[model samples]
Target: MSYVNQSQTLNVTSEQKYQGLLEKVLLSTLIAMPCCVFLFINGTMLFTLRSKSVFRGTSRYILLYNLLFSDTVLLALSQFLYTLAASKIMLSYPVCGVFTMLSILTDEISPLTLVVMSLERYVAVCYPLRHATIITIRNTGVAIIVVWAFSVLNVFIRVVLLLDFPFSDLESLQMTDVCSDIDMILSPMSDIYDKAYTGFVFLSAGVAVISSYIGVMIAARSASTDKASARKARNTLLLHLVQLGLSLSSTINNPLLLAISKTVSRVVFARMQNFLYVCFFILPRCLSSLIYGLRDQTIRPILVYYLCCRLTLSPQPKLRPKIHGVN
Candidate 1:
């Protein structure tokens, strides 16, 4: 009877392990489907932006391209890192640093680019006569350059703060926990700086977007302003606020997940985390694509054409070439 009980206990343990594995696989699949869909949509949107001379030359479109490009890069890297964590793959500090740094670099670009785009829209709506001169192609290029330089500067600061950690004392560089940005916060200053920098960037960006929204609203009242243009710009700025909120929320998800875990069972926490990852990370990256592709009259049909790849559902018509009989 003792031996029989031991066998039974072993069977139960094996079953539990199998169940846990199955749950993780299911969650990963659920998360991956939406992420892949969003990635595809974002890719299609990027291609659509570059496919036309008009899109390439337009300042807003140029800013849109930069925004979508960074968002897509961050989304892909985030998904990859999520998968690694889901599979319990623990990476070495140096290795994880490479991954995290790339992720951070791209992650920072979206919010800044949105701020630039907001200003472009503001000028278009509030100062219509000067829009062409102020938002020239060269000016847009300079804005993009400045945005990237600023993001890189932030990364450099993080690296400098990271140097404060003593790497020589460790027995091994392999991380004790799953590779994540939180895990890489080896020193108090790193964490403090990260929080401080993130807070400041988001605060500044939020104020800028809100200010643009107000500017657009005030302009809407003027007799010189085009009512339709002002209305559209107002709505666009509102959506910019939403995008900024989503981006800001993503930066705080780790703490939110930790709080959530304290109140829920392990199983429940895992499920909630997977759901939140999709909402916070994957979905926001694709909003630029959706917002511009569907909302803009110029891009809606063209975006549809590229997304479908002429799969009979494309908006663009197919042409058949006629051949005269050689005989």
Candidate 2:
């Protein structure tokens, strides 16, 4: 009776192993499909931004390029790690560190870049005369650089905290748990520091975006302000706030999943996690392309053209007569 009552399996069978593998494949495939689609869209958007001189020359467009570049890389890295975890692959400490670090580095850049973009819009509406001098190409490039440097500094602190772990004591560097940033939290201090850092970054970013929205709204009411331009700027700032909120939501994925796991069965938890991963992770990154590409009149046609595999979506321009009146 006692033997029959044992719930744990001491011996693993080949059939059970195959069943596990099959389930993993099924789950990963589901996530990978949408991830691939988003990646394609993001790639096309990135290429479209670079293809036009107008896009390349404009300050806001340059900032948009920086934002999309980070989002694209973050999405790709995340999917990679997700696939590895789903496949039950465990990476060594060093290998996983590099992957997660790159992931975090890119992940942090999105919100900060959004803040810069928001400020650019705010200035464009609030101080139209100075906008040209203020939001110059060189200044935008410097702002992009600063955003990256700040994110890198955050990642550097994380690396320092990781060193607190007694890695040398282990017989081998092979990690027993699935490789992830959460798994790498080997100490209480590390977890606390991560929470504090994430909270501060997101809170600061939220404030900056909201403040910009308010500034733009105030500028819209000014008598001298261009109503149409201010209205457009106001709308864009609102969308930036939404995008920042979505990015902020991603930082809570681990904590949220942990809370949900206790109340649900293992199977149910797994399903919920897969669903939430796509909703919280993939959709947020995909949003940037959709928000900018579909909404902006300037980008809409060219973006659609590239997205549809270079198929023309607009009326083709007629060629003018060549030299010597050649038609």
Best-fitting candidate, scored by TM-score: 1
lDDT of 1: 0.90
lDDT, candidate 1, 48-95, per-residue tens: 999999999889888888999999999999999999999899899999
- Cα distance off (Å), candidate 2, residue 179: 1.0
Candidate 2 local lDDT, 27-138, one digit each (tens)? 8888899889989999999999999999999999999999999999989998999888887799999999999999899999999999999999989999899999999999
TM-score (C-alpha) between model 1 and the true structure: 0.93
Candidate 1 residues lying further than 4 Å off, grouped into runs, are 312-327
